[model samples]
Target: MTDTLLTPGAHLFQAVEAALAGGCRWVQYRDKSGDHERRAREAQQLLDLCEQAGARLIINDDLALALRVEAHGVHLGQGDGDPAEARRLLGPTAILGVTCHDSLPLARQAVVNGASYVAFGRFFPSRTKPEASPAPLSLLREARAALPNTPLVAIGGITLDNAHTLIAAGADTLAVSHSLFGADAIEARARTFTTLFNQHSST
Candidate 1:
């Protein structure tokens, strides 16, 4: 599995290109800027780049933009509209992910509601969402046992220094933002994550 999940933030294009160059197959366009026109334009651009790389682009929130850009899918948070509705909009072929925030019930519900993958965390202190609740590794372990077939994503402050623990505890993908994109060497930082996943797969 290509588990390096690069989530776009401030430096959208730079972040996506660098991640894809490092062999990342998944990129989530996570713009919270609320500039509808700009977001649509960027998503359309990313859709082109991802298609060329054979990577998938998941738009964060904004179901309309995901459909307009015809991205791979849309990721929904606590109140980012209905997952089933998003699924209907994107059709059966598109990927649909949901943030469960360390709750098994929520994860299960997301799957029931037609989510393609489930995400958990703020595992560590996050530069992106510092006030977000911390999700324990125990949640990941339990989630793995609870949802065997579905992939689990671990997010928030996931640096190389602590990524191994999440992988070991049962995270299939690490959703990283600034810890990845803000680095002086973005491609190298992305490679570290890809390396971690590759090593895990080998073992």
Candidate 2:
């Protein structure tokens, strides 16, 4: 299967538009806390942009908003909804991702519970949410060994500086945040990271 790379954390339409310019295939809107009305509006705008760009948009931790906006998918952490329940609510075609942190057992359970992809992270120091659990490269290695066909996403502190190392460690997707959109020129940052991602894929 082709690797699925995601560029998340674009807080503005201009930033997200810039990311699309840089060839981002999948984007996720991941605001941890915000007013409901504002979140829904932002998600709707993002969904429209993603549709125009032909990129899939996944909402982070907001299933109801995602469903209301008809987003391409929804990513849920352990504190969020159960994957099986999400599947039941979203139906067979709706994409669902689960956050497994550093636990393989939880990952296996998520897959069985109907998660389309599993995300694990904090592989490096993360400025976005420092309190998120610090996972190890060893987690990726083990995850790959156990679930080769399943899409394994690595998040947190993923930057161009250490991207290749993470890819080599067996991450199918690099779910990044500040590394790309936390900048003035979102296109440039996205292009740089996408270029590095392509290089590693070609290797």
Candidate 3:
């Protein structure tokens, strides 16, 4: 299991490179509501950076841009796109992730519809965006028990301080943002997260 971090609101190239350098294996280039051309361009830049760093890159909510860049994956929220449609468009090898929030039903549906993984979140206080629902730690426990083979992702407000709790709750991956970028020592904080991830995996 690994903890994935999405790039924060900052210089895309710099952030992507920094995260990769700090050992972030998977990075999602998530930018909401930007113009098509700009978003496409940014996604491409991030993809290039990911390629150089040997890290997988996921584009958020834009299948078209993802397809254009041939990114590692595409992450879709409930209202973003039909998963089956995305699968059809992206072909068999493309990785697709669906935001399940707190619903096991939605997670099951996503898996059936060809999602590679399911994301649940806003586990703690979130300032990035208005989360419609808050998932509890128990949700991860239940989902893990129900969907044992599926890769489960925990998102929202995750930090080094509480990452162990989420891992203990059966979260396979922690999707983080602000906390990683907000630290004064980005590399050191990322190393802390990597160390925590190792410790969690060992336990």
Can you rank all candidates by lDDT, best first? 1, 2, 3
Could you tell me every candidate's TM-score relative to the true structure? Answer: 0.93, 0.91, 0.91
Residue 3's lDDT in candidate 2? 13
lDDT per residue as tens, model 1, 1-203: 11223334445676678788887888888767768897788888888878989999998877888988888998988889999888887899999999898689999999998999999998999877687789999999999999999999998888999999999999999998877777788788889899999998899
Error of 3 at 144 (Å): 0.9
Candidate 2: where is the Cα deviation over 4 Å? 1-11
TM-score of 2: 0.91
Off by over 4 Å in 3: 1-10
Candidate 3 lowest-lDDT run of ten: 1-10
Clashes found in each candidate (C-alpha, N, C closer than 3 A)? 0, 0, 0
Best by lDDT: 1
lDDT winner between candidates 1 and 2: 1
lDDT of each: 0.84, 0.82, 0.80
How well does candidate 3 match the true structure in TM-score terms? 0.91
Q: Clashing residue pairs in candidate 3, if any?
A: none
**Candidate 3 lDDT over residue span 1-203, tens digit each:** 11224443345566557667888887877766657787777777778878888888898888988999899889999999999999989988888999998899999999999998899987888766455588899999999998999889998888888898998998877787788766677667777777887887787
Score candidate 3 by lDDT.
0.80
